[model samples]
Target chain A: MPRFTAGDRVTVLDLGKPGHVRIPWFIRHKTGRIERYCGAYPNPEDLAFGRPGLPAIDLYRVHFPQTELWPDYPGPPGDTLEIEVYDHWLEPAEPLT
Target chain B: MTPEPIGYSADAVDPSRLVVEGHEGADYYALMTEAIHKILLEKQVLAPSDTDRVIAALEAPNVTWGARIVAQAWKDPSYKARLLADGSAAAREMGYAIKEAKLVVVENTSSLHNIIVCTLCSCYPRSLLGQPPWWYISKNYRARTVREPRAVLAEFGVAIPPPMEVRVHDSNADMRYLVLPKAPADAAERRFDDLVRIVTRNMMIGTELVEPYRDRG
Candidate 1:
C-alpha cells in the first residue's frame, strides 16, 4: 500500500538510469505536494518489456509551483505545478535543514 | 524467394525528383486483416460477420466520455471541482469507469494556462475519448510543444497576454489528460448546449478559447 495521499509532501528520488524514464527529467530532484491519487498501475520499467501483471505502484498527483520547476516561470505568485508520479520515484520529504 | 524487381530502380528517370515508396502488397493487407480478426476474437466483442461493421464503426467518430465530462463541467462547477480534485470519482459519477482509460484533468486559471501533449507517443484516453487529431501525434508538435509552448500556441493563433502564463502538460504515462479551460466571459449564464457549441474540441485542448459569435440578425 502507498503511504502518500493527496496534499502530502514528498521528495522524488533520483533513479540513476541512463535510458528514458517516464518521470520527467526536470522533476527528479524536486519536492511537491500531492494533489490527487491515481490508482495502482504497472511499473513502467516492467511494462516496457511486455511484462504483464507487474507489481502495482501508487501514482500521486503532485503540485509544484511553476517557479520551482523552471527558473523563468512567469506566473502569479501563488501559481502551482501539478504532475502525477509513481511511488518508487518519491520518498517522504526530509525535515527542513 | 528471389528478390522481387525493385519497383523504383535507382537508374530509372523520375519526374519531380520525389521518391515514392513501394506500396504494401495484397498479402500485407490479408495479414493485417487476419491480425485484426484475432484481436477482435480475443476481445470477444463481435462475431466474424460483424467485423466489417466494426471496421466501419471504428472509422466513424464516436462521442467519448472525455467529451462528456467537458460538457458536464461547463454546466456544473461542483462537478468540475470534483473532476480537478479526483478525476476517477468524477468520471464514475457520470457512469464511466476509471479503469477504462487513465484520465487526468489540467485546469486553466486566470494566472496559469495548461496544454496537453503526448511527447513519446499518442497515448490518449481513447476509452474516454475518441482518437486524437493527426497533429497531436506529429513529431513536430510533440518535440516542440514542451520547449516552445508559446510559439506553438502562436502558430495555432492563440496569443497569451503578458499577464497570463502557459504550462505544457505532458501526458506520457498510461494516464491521459483533458484541458479544463477557464470559461469564457458570460459563459456561466449560457445554456449547456450553447456552451458546448462554443467549446469546440480545439478549445478543450487549449489551442483556442471559446469566442462569442456575433448574431447575424
Candidate 2:
C-alpha cells in the first residue's frame, strides 16, 4: 500500500547522495500534492548499478505550483509542474495555507 | 593591387568553407550508442534481431495514433472518461502496443493548458506517438520547458494568456504522456473527419493546438 493518497501533500527530499537518481534537482526540496500513485517499482538508483533491487518502492506523480518552485515564477499560481517521485524521495508535508 | 586569380572570387575561400563537412552538432552520443550496442552484442545480452525489432517499433506507421484517441474521446464522452481513468488500458484496447512505460492522457481545458518535457532526458510516449520530434529531445527543450512553459509554448507559436494555467508534465520516469488537446469551440460547425485529420502530432505532444477546421469545399 502507498503511504500517500492522491491529494495528499508531499515534500520532495534532497538526500544529497551522489549517483543515478530519477528525481530532478529542480524538484528537490519542494512541496507538492500527490497527483497519482504510479505503482511500485525497483529503486532506479539500485537498478542503475545492476543490483537486484528486490524490494520495490512506490512512485507517485507530485504536482508543484510554479510559484513555489521558483522565486520569480512569472506564471499564475495555478501553473504546476508534475513529476514522478519515488516513496523514498518524498516525505509528508504540512498543508499550505 | 593584383587582380584575383582565374575563376577565383575573394569569397571562394571564405573561412566558412574550411568548416568540416558532416560533423556539426552531436556525434559523441552516436559514438556512445554504437559502442554500447557493440558491447551488448559481444556479451550476447542483445540479439541482432532485437535491435531490428526495436527499430521497427520506433518507425512503425501506427506510431502517432494519439490523434485517433483524441478524436474518439471528442466524439464519445464515455470513451473519454475511460481514457482518463486508465490511459494505458484504453490505448491498448485501441491496439497501441505500449512497451514498458505506461501512458497518462492529460486533457486541455479553457482554464488549463498542458505541456510536456523530460528534465533529465528524453522520455516520450513513443508507443502511441511514434518518435518524439528533434526538438523534443534537444537539450534546450529538456532544460527550458519545465522552467518557463508559457514562454516556451509561445516560442512554439502558442500564446496562453490570463486565467488559463500552464501545467508541465515531466515525463522522466516509468510513465509516458499524451495531451488531449481541447476541440475548438466551433467544432460543431466542422465535419468529424476534418477535425480528426487536424488533431495533429504536435497537439498531442502539447506544443500546438488544433486550428478551427474550415471546409475545403
Candidate 3:
C-alpha cells in the first residue's frame, strides 16, 4: 500500500509508457508541493484489465508552475498547474539545489 | 498543422445519421461488450454476439457531442436551466445516456469560473463526452487544474480578469464534469449546430471560453 499525504513534496516516477501512464509527460522528473489528499481509489492499471482487489492507492494533489513544467510555456509568470497523482508514482522531492 | 485522422469503425451508426453530434472513441468496444453482456444476461437481447461489430463501431470521442449540448443550452434558456438542474436528464433529452458514466455540470458565474480535472487517473465522462484529450489526462493538467486553474487557463490563452474567481472542479470520483461557460456577447441568435462549432473542446473543459469570430474568413 502506498503512503503519502498533503503537504509532502514528491517527484513523479516515470513508468515509461508514452500514453498509458496517468502522469502527464510534461511534469515527469519535476517536483512540487502536495495540495490535497484524495483518498485511496482503484488503481487505473487494475481497472483496465477488469480485475479487482488491487489495493487502493493514496492520491496527492500536487501543484507546479507552468514554466517549471515547460521551457516555453507562454503564460504569466505566476501561473501554475496542480494535478492529483498516486503515491507509487511519486518520491519525496529532492532537496533544493 | 495536419489534424489527426478521425478514427471510426465500420458499421457504427454514422455520426450524421444520429440527430445528436460528436463521434465516440475507438476503444468503446470493450465497454460496449460489457454493457451488452449485462443486457443479455438480463434477457434483453437474443444474440449477444450479434453486437460484436456494433460494439467496435461505438467507439468515438465524445467531445463533439458535449460541444453540441453546450451550444444548445446557450440558445435555449429552459434547456439551460434543465441542464443545470440535472445534467443526465438534460443529456437524455438530447438522446444521450449517462451510461456507466457520472455527469456533473459546473456553471460559470460572473465572478467564478469552473474547470474539471481527474487527478488520480483519467476518469472522464466517456459515455457523455467521449475520450478526454491527451493533455487533459496528462499529469500536468490534472495536477495543476485544481490548484492553479487560472494559470492553466492562461497557458491555454485565457486570462481571468482581476477580481474574477476561478473555481476548479475535480472529477476524481464517479462523477464526471462539464463546464458551462458564460456565453459570449452577441451570440444570442446563432443556431445550435453553428454555436457548437464555436465551442471548442477546450472551452467545454473550461480552459477557454467561446468568443465571436472577428471575421468569418
Candidate 4:
C-alpha cells in the first residue's frame, strides 16, 4: 500500500545523498501534489551497488508548479513539472508541528 | 591555392556544419560496448551467436506499435481510458509487453501539453518505440526540456502558446512514459491506417504535433 494518495501534498527532501539517487536536484525541498502511486521497486541507490534492495520502495508521481520551482519561470502560470518521487524522499506538505 | 584562411572551421564557425568523424566501433562508448560484449560472451552470459537474435528483438518494436495503440484508442474510447489508468496492462492487451518498466501514458489536451524527458538519464518506452532517437538521450535535450520546455520545443517546430500549460514529465524512474498525442480533427473520419500514420514518433515524444494531412491532403 502506498503512503500517499493522489492529490496529497508532499515536499521532497534533500538528503544530500552522494550516490545513485533517482530524485533530481531541482525538485528537492519543493512541494508538490501526488499525481499517482507509481508502485514500488528496488531502491536504485542500493541497486547500483549490486544489493538485493529488497523491501521495495514506494514511488509516487508528484506534480509541481513551474512557477514555484523557478520564480522567474518564463512560462504561463499553468505550466507544471511532474516527476517520480520515492516515498522516503517525500514528507507531508502540511506542517506536522 | 590559398590556405583555408588558417581557421576556416571551428565549432563556432558554422557550428552544426562541423563534423567529428568516428570509427564505427572505436569511440570511447562504442569500444566500451564492444568490450562488454566480449566480456559477456567470455563469461557465457551471452552466446556469440545470440547477437543477431538480441538485436532483432530490440529492433522489433518501432513507432508503429505506439501508433497502433493510439489509433485504437481514438477508435475506441474504452481503450484510451484503460491506457490512461494502467498503461502497461493496456499495452499488454495489444501484445506490447513492457518487460523492463511500467508504461505510463499521459494525454495531451487543449489546456495541457505533455512532454516526456529523463533528467537523470534517457529512460524511454522502448518496448513501443524501439530505440530512442539520438537527441532523446543527448544531455542538452535532457537538461533544457525540463527547465525551458517551451523554448526546446520551439526548436522542434512546436510552439506552445502562452495560455496552454506545458506539462513536463521526467521519466527518471522505473516507469516509462509515452505521450498520448491528441488526434487530428478528422481522425474520426479518417481510416485507421491513416490515423496511425498521423501519430509520429516525435508526436509521442511530445516535441511535435500530429498533422494528419501534412503528408498528403
lDDT per residue, candidate 1, A12-72, as tens digits?
Answer: 7777653446776556677888877778888777777677737788887777765676567
Q: Candidate 1 local accuracy as lDDT? A: 0.69
lDDT of 3: 0.68
Per-residue lDDT of B179 in model 4: 92
Worst 10 residues of 2 chain B by lDDT: B7-16
Better of 3 and 4 by DockQ: 4
Candidate ranking under TM-score, highest first, comes to 4, 2, 1, 3
Sort by lDDT, best first.
Answer: 4, 2, 1, 3
Off by over 4 Å in 3: A1-97, B1-58, B212-217
Tens-digit per-residue lDDT, B2-55, candidate 2: 996552222232422332323355689889999999999999999999999978
Question: What TM-score would every model get versus the actual structure?
Answer: 0.69, 0.82, 0.53, 0.86
**Per-residue lDDT of B89-201 in model 1, one digit per residue for the tens?**
78789887655456778777666677887766677655555678888878678766765677788899876664666767677665777787777677678777766665556
For model 3 chain A, the run of ten residues with the poorest summed lDDT: A17-26
Query: How accurate locally is residue A49 in candidate 2, as Cα lDDT from 0 to 100?
Result: 94
Which residue runs of candidate 1 sit more than 4 Å off their true CA positions?
A5-11, A14-20, A30-33, A65-81, B1-68, B92-99, B212-217
Can you list each candidate's DockQ? 0.09, 0.25, 0.12, 0.31
Each prediction's RMSD over C-alphas, in Å, is 9.9, 11.7, 12.7, 8.9
lDDT of each: 0.69, 0.81, 0.68, 0.85
- lDDT for A13 in candidate 3 is 71
Judged by TM-score relative to the true structure, which candidate is superior, 1 or 2?
2
